[model samples]
Target: MEKHGLRERKKQRTRHALIEAAVRLFEDQGYDQVTVAEIADAAEVSPRTFFLHFPAKEDVLLADADLRVDLALRAIAERDPAEPLAGVLVRAMDQMIAHAWDSDLPTGLAALRARLAASVPALQARLLQRYLTAQADLAQALLRAFPGRLDAITASALVGAMVGAVGAAALTALRRGDGPDEVRDAMRQATALVARSVT
Candidate 1:
């Protein structure tokens, strides 16, 4: 058990080092020019270690994605049994958005991600891929959470609409260079709108 804890701590430290290195390199040299090898060297880790932490380079810029998925899934699974599907989804999104906000300044990772998404084709492509995967994953989780009540089609549509609404609003705010508070407000309004329609 002590060994497991040490291993996890080591992994977290390595991941943090890689993220710090990648962000600094990307800032200094731009995203497209900073290769995985360079990031690994900067982090004092092997290229293989980089892969173990992240599937691809773009993921470094969007590191919060896994946390977002896990948060949404946990919220769904742990919701009250009597809660409606829409309520569960809205709650999940609320928590996810709140997590993202975190009292960040205007020049935080959210803004950096937005800037990169607008400039870098690879980041944009990765964003699309991540969105699709997240939707599918969230839908599956929802199906499991409300087995008899929701068919695949309904589950897909509900998840799609909720995710789509939140994405659209947040992306719009990001593109407009909105600060954390503004982005949070936009996301809250978006989720509330979806809840109204779904319920």
Candidate 2:
């Protein structure tokens, strides 16, 4: 177990280093101009090590995205079962957003997203895939929470509505071209919409 833990920590460190290197290179010379080799060089790792850490540059940007799905499920599990699904969803969204919103606020994500938005078609596809995966995971969690009471279709519909609201709000924030405040406001509105719809 100790060896496993140490190996996991080492893996995480290498992954973090690669992401940091990618971010620096993307910021300095623009994402389009930077290559995986350059990022590996910056991180003092081989190109093979870079590939082991990230399949592509886009993966670096989305490194922690799946973590939100796990967090959302955990948040839902913590809520009162008597609470409406909408209430649970709002609470989960609040938790997830708070988890993502570091002291750096929206600037960090916005900057990274902007770079990916401009430079990588693969990143755009990955974003869509992530959203769909998140929605499916949330729907499964909702189904488990209800324990055979709610049918799959109803659960999926609920998930779809919540995901749609969040996605629309995110896009609006991205389009606004400003700071974290606007993004936060947009997400707040989205979660509120989810709560209202689910209730």
Candidate 3:
């Protein structure tokens, strides 16, 4: 167990180094111009190590977004069981949006995402896929939370709607302008939308 823990810690350190290197290189040279080989060299790791940390280049920039899915599930599980699922989801999203707002993600993160979406169809598809996966995860959590009370389709739709509302609010805020205040307002609106649908 000790050896396994050490191995896991080493793996995590290596992955973090790779992600940091990739982000620095991407920020300096722009994402399209920075190759995996260059990122590996910058991180002082093998190209294979870079691949182990991330499936593709764009994922380097979006890894935090993916990590939030599990966090959302945990948040739901922590909510009052007496509350309706929709209420729980709204609370989960509130926690999530608050966390994101606090993360202080580099301005370049949003700029890079916009650039990638415009320049690469695959990245756009992957972003959509991430949201879809998050929905499925949340749905499964809701299923387990409610036991046999909720059907899969209903759970899926509920999760989908909640995720979609948050995404829409975020995109709307981004399109309007940039500022934490705007982002917070958008989150509030999004959560309100979900809240209204509950029970």
Best by TM-score: 1
lDDT of 1 by residue, 125-191 (tens): 9989988899999899999999898998999999999988988898899889787898999999999
- Assess candidate 3 and give its TM-score to the true structure: 0.78
Q: Write the per-residue lDDT of candidate 3 for residues 1-199, one digit (tens) a residue.
A: 9999999999988877777787678778877789989989998998898888888887876767765766788887877868877678777787777766754233345545655676677778888788778788889888888888888998888887877887777766766666776766787798888778877
Model 2 worst lDDT run, 10 consecutive residues: 102-111
lDDT scores in order: 0.86, 0.77, 0.76
Model 1 gets an lDDT of: 0.86
Compute the lDDT for candidate 2. 0.77
Error at 175, model 1, angstroms: 2.2
**Residue pairs whose backbone atoms clash in candidate 3:** none
Query: Order of candidates by lDDT, top first?
Result: 1, 2, 3
State every prediction's TM-score relative to the real structure.
0.86, 0.82, 0.78
The numbered model that scores best in lDDT is 1
The segments of candidate 1 whose C-alpha lies over 4 angstroms from its true place after superposition are: 102-107
For lDDT, candidate 1 versus 3, the one ahead is 1
Can you list the residue pairs that collide in candidate 1?
none
